[model samples]
Each structure stands twice: as structure tokens, then as C-alpha cells.
Target: MTRPLRLDALAYGGDYNPDQWPEEVWHEDVRLMREAGVNLVSLPVFSWPQLEVAPGVYDWAWLDRVIEVLWAGGIRIDLATATATPPAWLVRSHPEMLPSDSDGRRLEFGSRQAYCPSSPVWRANVARMARAMADRYGEHPAVVLWHVSNEYGDHVARCWCPESAAHFRRWLEDRYGDLDGLNEAWGVNVWGQRYTAWEQIEPPRRATGPVNPTQLLDFERFSSDALLELFRIEVDVLREVTPDLPVTTNFMSLLRDLDYWRFAEIEDLVTDDAYPDPADPRAHVPAALNYGLMRSLKGGRPWLLLEQAASAVSWRDVNVPKAPGRMRIDSLQAVAHGSDGAMFFQWRQARYGQEKFHSAMLGHRGEQSRTFRETAAFGRELQRLAPVKGTRVRSRVALVVDWDSWWGSSATESLPSQRLGWLAQARAWHAALHALGHAVDTVRATGPFHGYDLVVVPNLYIADAAQAAALEAFVASGGSVVVGPFSGVVDATEKVHPGGAPGPLRGLLGIEVDEPWPVPDGAAELVELDGERFDAPVWSEWIEASGEASVVARYATGVLAGRPAVTRRAHGAGVAWYVSAALAEGGLVAVMRRALADAGLPARTRIDPDVEAVTRADDETDYTFVLNHGAREVAVDVPEGAEDLLGGDATTGRLVLAPLGVAVLATPRAAEPPFVTLSETTD
Candidate 1:
């Protein structure tokens, strides 16, 4: 197999839509970008309207000029397909291409991503434009990568129009193979849902008898698959022309409308558009978690921070600017969490439209703004630390991110509470991993399972026989694993897997779940971890020990009081931990920390808890990134002697880092300690 692309250091810069502005302003934009140390620009992203002003007609004059200007300024271009949204003419000409919502209302074509993915008309037009764009610009020296489409989740769900209904039936036939298999899988007998003909199956809708939970879940899976097929169509066209150039679509972090894990498998590279509110205390955790997920899905390959607000996002109800130094701090946080590049949603502010008020390095007022100055300062720093790019950030921990399980668990209508969703649990687990600074990758069960010292499957509600066997073998072979609550409840068909709860993982975890004791909506239970007790609530499952696994933590109060909330069993050289309840953030963090340490994949000691740290290695040297995510100043104790990339200062014992500050330290290969080296490759 061919190895993935390796970036030299974290690439800098962000989305640039010079097509929205006058040609006269292009040079100043390039100059400002160069001064800010911007090396990459995601060009012509929402330019479909400009590209195809009329049917079968094309305009490349404006785009050609912008690409030439950026390339002249020494910036690599991540060229977009300019088909995020079909032009107004296409929508007006082919009204059948428009999507209908779950309520049976046809959507209008004002916002982006409004076209129906399953529409033959939309697909053909998008492919035609994509081929034309690539044919004209594939070999351009300035084009480093191709972005197939913008964030792909919008208009992905609730398509009930005739085209979608026909496509949905075809998708079901392909998945189940026949009507008998489909009936058994969906448990159609339960509520007269059994279908003698495939045409009877409709996309899950509220009007469809409040929709069976199992059918609803299957529809979600089918919807994601449908969207994936659309994305594949665009990707196929792009790859046919530019086989050497990498291709990707920007993913929205923690989005539910599409399965990102599936997308990671098809795209040459993975990129995410993350915009976290600085005011939210847990904002940093999502960014870190996303980095880990991206790295995991790509199997240690560097992913890009494709689109972040340079300052604040105007899309929110209350747009708040990131406090002083927060943008720089967050950018370094991206690098610390394994991002190969850091780029914003825009380089310059838009003059009109929804994103017009969004933050940018150069606002409408131009280069005289503070955002521009700070952006330039950070850009220069990235250039100085260019040597760190393409270096590998290794970790022994792995998180199993299953879209099937996520959909099945979240779509269950009779669950304890809608608030106890699978996405919430996944985010919780992700946040815990980020807090510990572990380099985590989100891997599918079918993917290679070797090399990870510890594997965590949070709320894996659905599993196939093959995946179940893989988990068993992984644990038996001395790899530690953690299975969170609600895992192993259903089979691939979304039906209860029978035998016992956590049907497949029961034997591996040495526990058989007897019944799930649902916690009242507003109630909570306490559990002791280490010494101090922590409060946890939501859903709790009661399990009877059938093997040698020992209970570690128990509920403090309840009818099933003293029951195991957390359990562990030794399978071979490694162990498997089963968490049977929703744990608070503090408790979850502590549990993962102990499990990771027990597996010989402990967190780094040199870095402070508040100081996010990560190490990337090249053929010769290793670059350690230390970023202060806290507000107050932190004194970091460095080795006897080391060179700082930002200040060019020699650091010894105590280095003070200001609020939202960052430091890139270079350490010689021979001088590194044994622990740091072992930790990076524990698996």
C-alpha cells in the first residue's frame, strides 16, 4: 500500500474568497497574508454562482487571477470544487432537485448545501463542473490539494421526494438483499411494519406512525450512506483527472447527519471545520477530541484544521470575539492535538451575506485591523517552526468510533431520556482523552486493530459478529480495552443481540448485564474514585458477574445500590474495563487515566495538566509542542538546555508561559528520556 502524505510542519493560512471582492484588492490581500506567515489558502470555496452563471457556460477569469496572485506570493492553494451549492439557475430549472424536509415541505434554495444529494440532475451538474475545473487546473503548480465540497451535512437528512424515495428503496434492497431479510431486520412484525414489497418502505418520518425506532435508526444509516455515495461521485471525478493530488471534504466536528468515519476511509486526507465558543469552559476539549478523532480515522496521518474563525463567528445568536491571545492559543492547541495545518474559515471578511460579519484576519477595513496584526505575527511563528511539520505524533490509545452504533443508540425512541444520547457519550469520552493529552485515533472495528495499547468504545450499541470477534481477539492478545455503557446492546440489524446485554462484549468483559436501571431524569448517584467521591447520573445498567472481572466502582444509592458501575477483567497480558453507567466528567477522566497507565500508556509527566503538550517526530529530530490552555501564567520546567522555536531563547529550568501562550521546543534525539520514547509507542 502507498504511504499517506507527510506534511513538513503545521501548514498555516485559511479560506480565501477573493472572488467576492474586487480584482484591485487581491494584491493587498496576498501581501497581508504573506506578512501573517500564511502558507496555504483554500480558494474559490463558494464560487459556484460565479463559475457557472448560466447553464453550460463557464467563467474562469476571476478564479485564474486569484490563483496566480496567491501562488506568486508563495502560498499553496487547497482548491475547492466550487460546487458547494448549485447555481440559482439549476435550482429554478430543475425544481425536482430540491430536497423535501421530514414534514414534506420542499426546501428553498437560499442557504448553501440546499441541493438534494440523490438528485441525478444535481449530481450530473456537480460532476460536470468538477471535471471541468480539474481538467483546467489539475496540473497548476499552485494547486497542492483539492477540496471536493464544503461541510457536507446540510440537506443530508429528511429527503422524501420521489427521487429520494426511489433511491431509498434501492439502498434498502442493496443492504438487505431481499424483502424477507428486510422484514426480519427491521422487526416489521412488531407494529405491522412488515413489508411484502420493498416499495412499502419509506424514509422514516414523524407522519409514518410516529416511526418505529428500529426503522428510524435504519433510515439514518441509509441516509448517511446515500450522502456518502454522492460524495464518492464527486471524488471519483476529481481523482480521475488529478490522481496525484490529494482530495478531501471538510467535516463538521461531532456532526450527526453524516458518518465521518466512513468519509475518512474514502478521502485521501481528513479535514475538520471546528468553531468552539471561547466562553464555553469545555470549548478546548472538543477541538482536542476532534484532532484525536481525525488522527485516529486516518491512522496517524496528519489532518487539517480546515476552517476556524480567525476571531469570532457571526453565525451564532451572540457572536463573541475570542479574548486577547485566544486565537493564537487555540491554533497551537490544534497543532498540539495532531493537526498538520491550521487555517481559518476566511482570510478576509465578507462584504455581504450570512458570513459577512464573521471574524477574519483582514476585516472589511483591511490590514490596519488588530486581527490582521495578530494573524501575521502567528504566521511568522509557524514559518519559524516549519521544521516540525510532517513529524509524527504517536500514542498507544485508540477510540472505537462506530457510526452504526451511534445511530442505533441515539435513535432508540424508548431510551431513558433523549438527553442521554450517543453523541453526548462520545463527546464525553473524547473530552476525557483530551484532558490527559493522549494522542487518540477513532478507528473502525474493521480497520487494523494492532498497535494500540488501549482501545475505548463509548456507547457502542450496535455490533456485527466480525467486529465482536475482533474485539475479543484484541483483548486476548494483551491489548487493554474499555467498553462504555449501552454498548453491545444490538446487532447490525438494530435488533437486540439476544443472550444478554452487551451481548458480544459480555464474555470479554466477564459480566452479563441482567437489566438496565434507568436513573430518574433529574436524579444522580455518587461513586468513589481513588479517594474522593464523584456524582454521576443518567443511565445505569445492572450486571451480574459471570466470570473473573472485578467491580471497581459502585453506585452509592439506588434500588441496585452497591452494584458495579465500573468493572475490570484480565483477558491476557492486558485487561478490559466495562463502565456500566453515565459518569461525570471528573470520574470519567480518572477512570481512563488509570486504565491507560495500567496498560503502560500513561500521560506525559513533564507537561503540566493545564499545559497541553504533544511531540511530533521526523527522520532526525522531535519537536515538542507545549501550549497553555489556561488563563493565568504557568511556569514550565524544561530540560537543562533546549532551544525555543518562537523566541529563539535558550531555556533551562523555569519557563513562564503567559495566558493562552505556546512554546515549541526542540530536543536532540540522543538526549531524550526513555519514558517519553516508550510512551509514544506503547502499543
Candidate 2:
């Protein structure tokens, strides 16, 4: 089993920016935090301009005092690198650092994610600042973790400038190697995109007619890599001084700017920022799935809920306040999926900024507000459930989520129709897994695959040889895997992989694809499974069985109607299942449930349907967190008589839970291993 972090229990409290207020207010903030049982404070997130007033000049008087005060108050610190927003001086002096949109227009200062990732000057300045900060605070007793550049992503296309364009050319050369290879890979012959010379290529610009989708896709990948390298620059600098401290950048949920699966391997820990709509019915399910993705990215490692709204967020067009008990319910949902800590965006509401109206532990009118009382109560409950706080949750199911394939599938210029995007299919499968209560992890083709009992690859269009070999090895070792529609069509270079449709995976899945029907938006086909017909939409791949595999489900109507829509083949001690049609949520769940059962990886907890339950275990005990997301009260059957960690009530059979009610049950303590122990310390 993988080792756990040194956290004692669930770390509570959140973003505390005393710099935004007067020094006299610090004591009152401390009092509120203490009352709320706040143990962790993420500090100095947006204080770069104040810290470094000019080039090569430093001022730590305010920061040092703040850290010392918080430490004295018994609160640990998660120190930020303070590189999110560059100072006005830097932007004024180096205008090249500013990002440009796809239309080739440079953005002005004012917004927070405005820096160009490919700028060497920006990277150098950030790296220098990071090293200096780490050197000053790495030895502090209260410092437990390093928060590298917060939420790095591109809100607009950048690097259309001469320097960035030059760098893009170099990146292309490194990736495609030579002009001939680049031409063939991008299929330049079809649309006059072929380059006779390296310098002739430029980053995709809006003026470029109907911008070739495949080329644009590669450009996006390049940009993500550039930003990831920027993150690495700061991480490297911090590691030089604080070698043992864990480093992480807060990831935005489903933002689509960067492929999180690739970045997960580089960061020491994966922490995500989630702000789901309180009224959206599918909100909690997607939140749970995203948390699972973070955990799986780190190989079943515990992650943190870096920034959530204590009440309501300030970014949306209509900021709806979370209903009664919804905040606590959402926090517990994070823990249920494997979060080691819960934190909010701000400790106190901002006074003069875009986020002035955002909810916090302490409102603008001091600690007299109801939000403060609710936050304190939640913190107290977290402290009470200390035993199961730091436990690690594991999963046997893996789902492949690849950025290259997602880009490739979306960029397809032709096919029968246009509605078969990769994200849609991935979300459909994700929803299916969530409905089934399977703790699913999102894995990339490059990640480790040895221990998982089942693996699902949905719309894996861009398949590489190495990844195909890994899947083969995994199946050979008795692990079952699923490969779905539009999979294995293209190689790493975005070109068709030549042998047949299903390309590299054809031999392993034991199927040869004859053609793929890209059904228009809202068009669907019915597939029969277990004598029940279900709707499968977006696209259908017509296939002919090769070796041992046979059809499991088939299309209901078409010229090639009644053909296979889903198939399975035995390989070694396991099986490889293929879905030729994009199955709906209900059908996908039914299909995956059967797959999990065959792999002996079905959900262990009793099904309540509406009452979502997830269990986490450590060396000492197992904790089951039950959440009632339904409107009416539901009776939850207890695994064994146990005490409710939130309320000291000992709950037995027929426990009635109100809407959005959360319950944490601690199972009887397991025999402690010789080297295992529990502590109350948190960072």
C-alpha cells in the first residue's frame, strides 16, 4: 500500500489575507479562526505587488509579522509563491510578458491570468521571486507546504508576437523533427498547410482561414506544455531550498485549458478548486468524479480541496447563496472521495475588489454573521471526526482521459456527423461511474497501470504504440479493460495509424473497424444488453469480429442495422470490452456495472440509490460518509452500530437523514499495525 501524508486529521480553515485589512483586525480574525477550529491558513496568494515593489528589491516586514502572528495563534501556514499576478511595474517595463489573443491583440494589465507562458523574462522573474521566498520561510516551523503559482491557465490565445512565434517554431521542430514529417503528420497536402521551410510555420492565428483543427489542436498542446514548464520553473526553485515540502498548483475543475492528467505526474500533490452550482442536479456527482480524478492522478494519494466557497462564489453571473446545510454537505462530499483537507477561497470577504461580494468565514460586518457561526460549527465537527480525517481511499477502477485524443477527436474535419466530441463521451462515462458509486480514477496513457482491476478508455482516438503495449501488458496480467468508440484512429502525430480503423488497438481488442457513422446532434441508435434496449448516440462504429471476440450489443436501425455496437474478447486471464456506439448514461452504467462485477470490483457498500455512500480506510479504521442528496428523508441502513462523528449521537438501524444531510460513521477500530499511529497535528 502507498504511504500516507503526515497530516493528523482533516485540515480546516482557508485563505486568510490579513494584508487586505488593518493590523488591528488581525486579532479579531485570529479569534474567529480559533473559535472555528481553523488550523490551516493559505496566505499571501495575491500579495506580489506589495512584497516586491521594484526589481531586485524585497520587503518581508508585513509577511514575517503575519506568519509569526498566525503561528503564535496555533495555525499552520500553506505559504504561496505570490506569483499569480505580476506587479504593475513588471508589466509596464516588459510589455512582452503580456499575453495576446488569437486575433493577435495584446491584453492590458488588470486581469489576473494575463502573462504569456512562453515569455522567458516572466519565467525568470517568477523563478527569482520564488527562490527568495522559499529561502526566507523554508525553515519556519509553521510552514508545511508550498503553493506554486495559483491556477495557471490561458484565458486567451497568447504568443502571437514575434518572439513567441519563433519559440513555437522551435517547439514544432522538436516535436515533428523535420519538415517532411511535419507535413505528413498535419496532412498539409489537403489544404495547402504544407511547409517548405521551418520558418514558414506560425502559431495558428484567427486570420488563417477556418484555422485547421488538427494544427490548432497541436498549438493548444504546446501552450499547455509551456505553462506547465513555467510551473516547473518555480517548483524547481522552491525545491532547492525546501527539499521536503510538498509542491502543488491549484487546478481549475474541467476548465479545458490544460490536460490535468499530464500535470498530475509532475506535482507532488494534486489539489483542485471546485465551485459547482448549488442548484444543478448533477453538481455533486461531477464534483465527486473530479475529486476521484485528482486522487487517481496521484496513484490513490490523498488530495486537498484547495479553494471552495464557504457560502457562495463571486465569479458567476448569478451568484446564488448555498442553501442551509449545503456548505457542510459539499465539504463532506470532498472527504468522501479522498480529500485530506477542506479550505475556502477567502477567510474574510474582500473589501475593494472583484470578489468583494464573495462569501467567507467572516463576512464584511465582522464575526456576528450567521456564516461565521456555521463555519465555526463545521470546523468543530471536523475536529471531532479527527480519527478518519487523514485516511487514504483506494480504487480498483481506472478511466483513461487523454488531452491529445480529446483534441484530436474534436478537431476531426470529416466523418458522417459532428456531435461526437471527446469531452462529451468522457463526461457520459464519468456520470455513469458516479451513479454507480465506483471510486473512479482518471489515468493518462503514460501513468502506472499495474494494480487497477478494471480500466475504461472512452473515445481514445489518438492511440500511441507504447500506450497500446501498456494496455496489452495490463490485460496479460489479468486486469480487464474497456476501449470504446472512435478509439485508436490516429497516431501520436495526429495522422491515421495506417493498418485499419481502431488502428493500434485493433489487434488487442480483437476487432477491425469497417467504418464509423457520425450521427448528427440528437440522433441516436438503440443497443440491446441483457434483453433491455437502451439509447446510444453521437456516433456508431461498424466493426467485424477478428479472433475470439463476439458482439455483445448491436445497433437497432440503419443500413448496417443490427450490427455490433459493443463487443468483448478474452485476453489472458482478463477481457477487453469495446463499445462501438456512444452509450447513454443509463446504458453506460449498466455496462460498467457488469464489467466491475466480472472483475470482482463492485461497490462494497449497500445501495440506497439516492443516499450516496463512500468509504475511506486507514490502518486504524474505515470511515463511511453517507450523503442524502434527495429532497425527502431517507432511512440509511448502518453497516454496524456506530457514532455519528458530526453529532455525538450513536446511530443504529433506520437512521432518517434530512435533505443534504451528512453523516460520518467510524467503524470499529481495526488492529493497528506495529508501525502505525495517529496524531492530532495538521499543516
- Kindly give the number of clashing pairs for every candidate: 7, 0
What's the lDDT for residue 494 in model 1? Answer: 67
- lDDT of candidate 2 at residue 341, scale 0 to 100: 77
TM-score of 1: 0.94
Worst 10 residues of 2 by lDDT: 673-682
In candidate 2, what are the lDDT values of residues 1-683, reduced to their tens digit? 12233456688988888989999888878878899988888889888988998887778998999998898998888899999888999999999889887678888899786688888888898999898899899889888888887887735434676667777888888998998878887888887777999889888876534666667778878878888788889988887788878888898876566878777767787788888887675688777667877777777777889889977788778888888788888888888788887889889998988889999888777677767878888898777767765577656677887888877666545545567777777777877766666666778775578668888888788888888888888887888888888888878766677966688887779998898876667677788888888887677777888759978877777655788888888888888999888888768877887777768765423333456766677866767677887666766556546777876677654456788887887776544211111112221
Q: Against the true structure, candidate 2 has what lDDT?
A: 0.78
lDDT of 1 by residue, 106-211 (tens): 8898887877778999989889989989998999988888898788875455587778888988988888899998888778788677788877877776564456
Alpha carbon lDDT of residue 626, candidate 1? 72
**Residue 677 error for model 2, in Å?**
31
Name model 1 segments beyond 4 Å from true: 1-10, 155-158, 529-531, 603-609, 669-683
Model 2 ranges with Cα > 4 A deviation: 1-7, 154-158, 411-417, 603-610, 647-655, 668-683
